[model samples]
Target: MATLADRLDRCYSGAIYDVMRDMGLRPGVLPRTIRGLVPDQRVAGPVFTVRGRPDPEVDAHTSLLEWTGLLSRAPAGHVIVCQPQDDTRALMGELSAEALKLRGVRGYIVDGGCRDTELIIEQGFPVFCRYTTPVDIVAAWRPEAFDEPVTIGNVTIRAGDFVLADRDGIIVIPADRAKEIIARTEAVIATESELRRAIRAGEDPQRAYLQYGKF
Candidate 1:
């Protein structure tokens, strides 16, 4: 049987959002400023949330140890969603991305900066962030907590919540509703296929929408 993450990985962002809205969840969309560096790639999985901030007083060595510790603590088969809370320096970089990827981490999404863009992109790792910079989080930042609640835009995300992201945008789905939302989205997609065929077969668009109760 496919796990919820596997099933969700197969669903697109739009359909998932529509299903959640129709189901009255009214899910919170992640900030538009935060977008996938690899737009053609889609990543979906349960989140391992990281919340961190700048610590200028910390030494570079200590900050690096703390940074690598974050990577080490991330569980395999999970997407790391981070609210770095500071945009002055890159929160992710080449070595971090490579480490996370080799460990079977699904992806990285951060509301901050990323360094080593070319290398990370070439590595085929999924990274979504606000921007890129050569300046890294050596002594400028430190992880405050993991698996704790973090907010991005209007969404207050918990560690276990499910996330589906693609070119359209990213949306958070409460873990408890993953199965229900996925099942409904499958039904909606089937209806859309039928409606599309009807429209292509010369049926009036409005009539097809009426017939299928959707368009």
Candidate 2:
């Protein structure tokens, strides 16, 4: 059997949203402003939550130490989702992206800005954020907590909850329901495939949708 990450990577955001809707689950989507670094850079995995706060009084060296410590603490095979309360400076940069990627972090998503966009793009590390900036979190930010619930848009994301993000948008599934959600999404995709086939085979689109119960 494929792992949840493997199954999720094969799933797209739209179909997942549809499945969750049919199940009456909240559409745990992030804000539209926060988006992937590169086009078609889809990411799906269990999330490692990171939250930060402004610390303007801290010295650069101390702030950097704390930041690097957070980097070292991140585990492999998980996407890091951050809620940096500060909005001006970037929470992620070239070295940070490289370090996380080297350490096997699947990807990163932040509800703030990012820096070193060109280099990060060159590295091909998936980073979803609201915008890009040259300002960085040197002495202005500090890691507040991890694995705590953080709200990005209308959804509260907890650690270990699964996320599916693509060109359309990002959606979160409660950890307890992730597997079931994926299974349902796979079934939805399969049904959609059959629906497509019938329509292409000269069947009326409306009739095919009625026959397949999906459009």
Candidate 3:
């Protein structure tokens, strides 16, 4: 069986995204609070997804604590992707990152916001998000559920989907399509390489692109 890290290292966010786009599937972004701790650190793993809706009346401090506890039990290399209804709150921070790190998590992809940017960057964890903020998730919001489906951008992400994220962005490959996508992606890479070689050898870029259907 291939480990999560192994699969992640084998693919790039761009390739996976292209595959999904070609297939007409839209995937969402992981929460922004979850970030990378290392430089150039990309994570590929099965998503242990969470969905949170706005609840100004509920106290989220306790909910976050409990959520972190649940995440600690996630299988090794499981990437925790959270979708908070409100993109403004900083749902992830140093403490949460530390806990996830201990659990052998691959990384995080969030659409909201994050804090402790300096520490997270220093820790060399890979995180992808819309922005960073100093505000924390506390009295503002609560985690309404887990292991549920969420949407980011045009992508629909469900728990257990294979997630590959890098500097370009995040891509979710349905669990059932992992092997197929991997095979297709390999062919794409090879074709692109050949096309590049042809271009370098003085072939017209347009001709090369048309021949391979890729630039």
Candidate 4:
């Protein structure tokens, strides 16, 4: 049998969202402001959460420590779901992305700006962020915590939750519920596939939806 992670790797964010909703889970989706740096890049992995904010009190030495610490701690096969409370600085760049990739980290979902996007895209690293900027964290930002619950848009994301992202958007499924959700999502996909075939054969969409309960 395929693992939940493997099954989820084959699932789309939209299908996963519907499955989660059917499970009575909110399907915590990051806002539309975030988008993939590389077109068609998709990521599915357990999240390693990071939360940070702008702190005017920090100086050069402390800033160096902060950046290095966050970068070094991310484990392999995990998506870095970062919440940088201050949106001015670019929290991710080419060099950091390179390190994460080498460490086997899957991708990034940042609720802040990112820089060196051209190089990041060139490296084929999947990074979804609010925007791109040339500004950096040297002057005013520091990591507050990691592996902690953080909110993005209206969603509350906890460390270890599964993150699935594509051009559509990013969605977080609670870690404990991922397996069940994936199983149901596979069934949902089968139903959708059947519905597609019916529609192509000239079946009315309304009738197909009525028969399949999905369109």
List residue ranges in candidate 1 displaced over 4 A.
none
Please, what is the TM-score per model?
A: 0.97, 0.98, 0.81, 0.94
Please provide, for model 3 over 105-206, each residue's C-alpha lDDT reduced to its tens digit, 9 standing for 90 to 100: 877777777889788777776666667889876666666667788877667888878887766556678877777777777677778789989999999988
Model 1 clashing residue pairs (backbone) = none
Q: What is the C-alpha RMSD of each candidate to the true structure, in Å?
A: 1.0, 0.9, 3.4, 1.5
Q: For model 4, how does the per-residue alpha-carbon lDDT over 72-187 read when each residue is reduced to its tens digit?
A: 99999889999999868899999999989998898988999999999999998889988889998985799989999999999989988898999798989998887788889999
Give the candidates in order of TM-score, highest first.
2, 1, 4, 3
Which 10-residue window in model 2 sums to the lowest lDDT? 35-44
| Best candidate according to lDDT | 2
Inter-residue clash pairs, candidate 2: none
lDDT of 3: 0.72
Segments in model 2 whose C-alpha atoms lie over 4 Å from true places: none
Clashing pairs in 4: none
Q: Candidate 2, after superposition: displacement of residue 87 in Å?
A: 1.2
lDDT digits (tens) for residues 1-215 of candidate 2: 88899899999999999999999988798888889888788888999999999987999999999999999989999999999987898989999999999999989999999999999999999999998899998888999899889989788999999998899989998999998999999999999999988988999988997899999
Candidate 4 regions with alpha-carbon error over 4 angstroms = none
lDDT per residue for candidate 1 within 12-122, as digits (tens), equals 888988888877788779988888887796788999999999998999999999999999999999999999999789988888999999999999999899989889999
- After best superposition, candidate 1 residue 204: deviation in angstroms? 1.3
